[model samples]
Target: MQIVILKDAAEVARYGADIFTTQLQRKAGAVLGLATGSTPVALYQELIRRNQAGEVSFKNATTFNLDEYLGLSGEHPQSYRYFMDQQLFDHVDIDKNNTHVPPGDAKNPITACQEYEAKIAAAGGIDIQLLGIGRNGHIGFNEPSSGLTSRTRVKTLTKATIDDNARFFAADEYQPHLSITMGIGTILDARKVVLLATGENKADAVKAMVEGPLTAACPASALQLHRDAVIVIDLAAASKLADIEFYQHIEAENQKLQAYLASL
Candidate 1:
């Protein structure tokens, strides 16, 4: 687990974009794992900018989104499909057919989950995975008590996640109670992973993910065991860390730390 305390969210976004650009340059047509949330909005914008500038090309790149709200059609405004099209897929040169989002409204969601995981494997797995932590430390809707080796499956949203995500819908009642998400095991299979967090609301969960014990209760803590995961956070989100200064010092010392480092 390596910690990067960026000065602000914009800087974090820039750094993330740089990572993707460099990776894509080194390995064209990379398979990417994407996360959708306010946390990644700026990063997506940065990538779009790079695409327009011809500094990067996602023409052949493949994307696999982390999760999607169950019971919502792809055309639904609040659906992950709609969100990705609006925020990223629409702006880039990525082949529309190369992008994959788990079927949110599949009648047999369990089969859909298995097929999603299989498709990722067939594409050679993800080269880099982007993640956003839920307020309760869930990743890809894999809430507490979720098995570490769980595969893609349907998940019931915790009340807290529902409340946090409610702002996207017309009303709380519009929020889907279930979601289809990649398992923690699936995420760990990526060659590299980047988890981003911002704002004071994320402070406690960020701290727990960074410094607390690796327990199922805080699913994000599983990153501690991953060999290739980087956590980029803004100052506010990192505020609760017991050794913020230490993290800052390390970042200052090595601006080019590898994507992963042993857990601190």
Candidate 2:
């Protein structure tokens, strides 16, 4: 696992965007695994800027979103489908036919999950996956206790996740109790992964993910086992991490070393 501590959320977003753009450039028609949430909003915005400047083009790229709230229609404002269209797909050149979000209202969600996983496989697998950690360490609504090797399936959201996501709806009653998400094992298959977090509210989770033990309780900690995963966080979110300054200083030194090597 690699950690990058930025000065603030905006910097973190730009860094994430740079990473995304570089990866897209390396593979123009790459399959991108996406996530929707406030944390990644700025990164999407930066991508939009790059698209407009012709620094990058996503016209040929394919996208597969991380999860969706079961029972919600795609038109629902709070649904992941709506969120992605509003924040990303609509703003970029990504082909509508190439983008996919799991069906929230499928007649048989279990079969839907299997098909979703199959589609990912058919796309040649994800080249890069972007993630955001829930307050309780859930990824793609795969709450605590989710087996690391689980596949795409229906999951019951924990009370904490429901409460945390309640802000998106008009009332608590509007929040869906169930969600469909990819399993950690599926996410781990990606060629690269980038997880982003910001704000003081995320401090504890970020610390646990970066420095705590590898336990299912902190699902994000599983990234420790991934060969190519990077965690990008703002200073406030990284505050609780031990030896954070040492990590930051080392990163600075590495940058200087790279620059010196280039000059040579």
Candidate 3:
């Protein structure tokens, strides 16, 4: 696990984008696991900029979104599928057919979940997974007390999660009380993971994730057992982390080391 604290959200986005672009550059067909929510909006925008400038290309890459509202179709504006299309896919040259989002309204949701897991395996597993922790320490809708070794499947949304997502819906509109999400076990399979958080709202969650014990209570903490997990946050979001200065110092030293090695 590596903690990278940056000056602000924009810097966090640049750092996240660099990680993805580097992965795609090294492996053109790398399978990318994506997440929805505002935390990654800037990172997606940065990737689009790089694509437009010819600095990188996602034409041969495939992507899988982390979760989707249980009853919404891909065409629904609030669905993760639509979110990805408007935010990243429509602007990039990637093949639309290669991108996958769980079938939220499938006739047989159980079977759909099974197929989703199989599809990921067939794609040779994810090379890198992008994540954004919820204020309650949830990841991919695996709320508090969710199984640590759970798999892709239907999950009931806690009241806290529903409330957190309420802001995205209109006052009188319906909001989903269920979702299909990849489990902690599935996410940990990724060769690499990058989680980004920003704003003061996320400070507490960030602290718990980085400093808290590995427990199902904070699903994101499962990353502690992952071989490679990188957490990037801005000053506002990293405020509650007791060892913030230590993390910053290490990041600075790492940069200097990389530069020294490159020059040699």
Candidate with top lDDT is 3
lDDT of 2 by residue, 1-264 (tens): 878999999999999999999988988998999999899999999999999899999988999999999999899999999999999999999898999999998999999999999999999999999999998888888898888888889999999998888888885457789999999888888889999999999999888888889888988888888999989999999999889989898778878997999899
- Give the clash count for each candidate: 0, 0, 0
TM-score, per-candidate, Cα-based: 0.95, 0.96, 0.97
For 214-234, candidate 3 gives per-residue lDDT tens digits of 988899989899999999999
Q: How far is 25's C-alpha from truth in model 3 (Å)? A: 0.7
Q: What is the Cα root-mean-square deviation between model 1 and the actual structure?
A: 3.4
Which rank order by lDDT, best down to worst?
3, 1, 2
Clashing pairs in 2: none
lDDT of 1 by residue, 116-192 (tens): 99999999999999999998999989999888878899999899998888888885357799999999999989999
State model 1's lDDT.
Answer: 0.92
| lDDT for residue 251 in candidate 3, whole number 0-100 | 86
Better of 1 and 2 by TM-score: 2
